[model samples]
Target: MVKITNKEAICIAVLFLLGSNIVIGSGMDVQNDNWIAGIFGFAYFVPFAFMYARIQALHGGKDLPEIANHLFGRVFGFIITAVYTWYSLHVGALVLRNFGEFVKITTLTETPLLVIMLSFSVIIIAAARLGIEVMGRLSTYALPLVVLILVFMEAMSVSQMNFDFVKPVFVHGFQKIARAGFSAFTFPFGESVIFLGILYSLKKRESAYRIYMTGMVISGIILVTLTLMNIFILGPVEGDFYFPSHSSFSRIRLGDFLQRMEGTISVSYAITCFIKASVCLFVACKGIASVFGLSDYRFITIQTGLIMTYLAFILYKNTVEMENWVINVYKYYAIPFQIVIPLLIWIRAEFKNRKGKRPKKSEELEINGGEQEEAGNEF
Candidate 1:
């Protein structure tokens, strides 16, 4: 069904991982040393990423819902799939609200948050309607623009960096760094759990290990670099800005010729965020279809997108509340869905594989010298 090459899958993963982190910046609790926290966060998430990849390889073309139903039994699997579907929707809404808040506070000061969110929701719903294949192909193009934008932002602001801000390693002690690293793992890194919804569409199931591992490593580096760049560009007063990456980008100016670069960078953030929202919505739709025994997920894309828009509106009263929730509440709220349940699934998959339940090579046909194609799905 819905086939995508390993390259497309990895691109989507990188962009999805970069998503909101580009706008809000990650590991913020540690302030200037957030990069250190991000590095450790990536380290902490490495094993789990491999485990997730293994789950994909073991299950082959089976998406998470199917795997759950087969491994956990129908009733329990239905419950687990429902919970994960809800988590996907909830995370998508949180991200939609984040971008809405960013736009409202920054460039579109007068634009209604509802309008901004609805606009983005329409785009996301359209992309979801196009299905996973289209989404995967789209990432092949969009990710490069995002990468270029990040490079430009870093280069343009290179002169503004202050070496002094990086002094006194772990100035706030290891506790805060660990806390921030935990937050980083949960929010961005651990959230890769949602990939189970569609990564099954990957052309060659064996590529899951390479896809997940490579994407996470690249995204982790980008995230850590952005965090460190913020510290360097803003120096000791980096804490003064809520969106440090955006603030740092705003400082770039090549004598009025290249002024206001954050505008371009802001567009890049929106592109990546849009990809994240689209993937989340698409996954939620697939999960719903699987749970309810529907043939296709097309019918519910609009409904789910609108629902996400409304939930985003009611998610937080303002940016302040949202920021507080992300920094303090979201970490704990996201842990069970992203880590606990996924761990359960991984354990079961491993047990099944050991019990000779692994899918045979015949289940998937990889031919044409790796230029693979999967069975088509009209859905």
Candidate 2:
């Protein structure tokens, strides 16, 4: 029900697309499988980006749940909506956990993990409670700082770059590299599927394709460039170390006065993570509202945030356990819900169109006209 301008929608998409997931997830993928993972990751977005654009074009300013309801019936529609709602919360929790681990390991080693989580939950809940407009505005303001930190990190580390490190890039077997690519693509890029919920709020639906695809392309380029840079500076061996990008920043030295700038990346990542979490929280609420027929969407934020916090706590026993979950559970659980369900809805919409037998609410009302008239007469 909240109206947003095209520019605001684009900004939100960018925040959703290039959040802590890319920063932390990319590094995690690279650490797991070297630079090959980045390559596969980029490829994963190709179809995902197209699927999103196609679904938006077909629906024309409707969320996925609405589209599902149109093509399917209310029963199935509610089911799909519930699945998406769960998916969004699960993703929110996963990203929160990832960020919590990153901060605890890198910057705030002494801070209790629960304290960090509660702090993050408070910020995310606050932003979500302010509504989508504020979240979009915050992203517009924060994106520049995040980009600047990335640029500065890349610039300062330029001298340390060694192309030879990424050389023999396919030194790993093609099959292994391809598998890594599958993992990368699924984690950061395919996850963009969640943004479909907000596409209807854009002032210009036609521009959704251009804005989203462009954002993904830009995000992919950045991720690939960062992966290459990490490999160049840290070598393949060191790139495998946890938080390679942070480590790369730690090595920066600008005439001895501009040192220890690694925290700059951390600051940027924190802001990006906040925006990402906010967007996920908003989408989760929207999906729930659509499912339960809630008149006010903002009311669900606290309850959902609490649920998300508890889910994050239960998601992983530790960082290593979380990483294993990301590799195994996430791909299996997320892919079907994120990719398959939307694809089915889109296909059903088209097929129903071909049959010229799509159901409409007006038709349903007309069919029940006698009962309505009798009830009105009784009243």
Candidate 3:
């Protein structure tokens, strides 16, 4: 099996977290306190991150579907695996649509969304054909550049930023803060659950916890920074814009030289979203292959990518529905797949592993006793 180091895994996870987040607000409902909401969200995801990492660490070096099937029976495993694959496929489509929308709305107004998605799909399919190791390498190179762009953009826009915009903090009260935390957790942060499929290919199984924790911490910091920047630049109306970061950056004006710097945000989104989409497709294809007993998943990569492109085109009527669904429904909708299944799997893995190890421990004790008795007799 192809193996990726924990470093590469962390890179992939960071980019994945930042992908849709660059264009989407984390806690838009709370307006100026979005960064606080982001903090709460990260805190909420920490324990589950450990759970996810521990499960992957325990069952490392195997594909997720294979692990599931072994832990559960073939039929039940197939069912759970299918659930995860579908989540990846559907989210990949959502990521694709987000990319298309950003490009279409921000740059190519006349260009067709389908064409834009198709173009992005071509690259994702290429990455899939190349393999996970290549994907990791690409992420390693791309993440630094993408992050640098974010820093540069934030720096450039700093001159125009108004610190008072985020004033009157926490006026929304604890319930609202907690609600925003829940929303943020379910999205960009909690979605880390999907990394189990990717983490199984890690070079060092023990690094799974480090990868998840480090990835989330890095991405969480970047996200909180971006969230604060958006609120600082856009004020209470920050939540009004569908793409808050882009909107805030677009307002930058450096004596007409570097005006409308939002293009850099587009470039950033394209790079990270591409990585996210590639990972999703990789996980989905791999799961499908494991289920059907296929020898390789690369055979279906192109077909799956194209299907994702098509779904991207049809998933929502416009950005308004996308926003509504994201803010209103997505958090609750994702609970079963993101929270319930992973929790069940982790609990089962702990139980089965402990129960399965008891026999080995007892057997070892018996063998040691026999060896000691033999030594006593000889002496």
Q: Which candidate is the best by TM-score?
A: 3
Candidate 2 global lDDT: 0.76
Instruction: Please provide, for model 2 over 170-286, each residue's C-alpha lDDT reduced to its tens digit, 9 standing for 90 to 100.
Output: 767777777667766677777788878777776666777886777777677677777777778888675445566788788888886988878887887788678778878888988
TM-score of candidate 2 relative to the true fold: 0.88
Candidate 2 wrong stretches, greater than 4 Å: 27-36, 356-379
Question: lDDT per residue, candidate 3, 162-271, as tens digits?
Answer: 99998898989988898889988988877777787888788888899998889999999999999999888888888899899989888999896779888888888889
Off by over 4 Å in 3: 360-379
Report the lDDT of model 3 for residue 256: 65
| Candidate 2 positional error at 293, Å | 2.3
Using lDDT as the measure, what is the rank order of every candidate, best first?
3, 1, 2
Put the candidates in TM-score order, highest first: 3, 1, 2
lDDT of 1 by residue, 1-379 (tens): 6689999999999999998998686635776777888887898899989988888899899988998998999999999989988998988998899999999889889999999999989999999899888888999999888898898779888888987888778998998888888888986988888999888898888899998899999999898888889888887576557688889888888886877778887888898889899999998998888888989999889998999899999998888898888888988898888788888998988887787865557553445424443333322
TM-scores of the models, in the given order?
0.92, 0.88, 0.95
lDDT of 2 at 132: 76
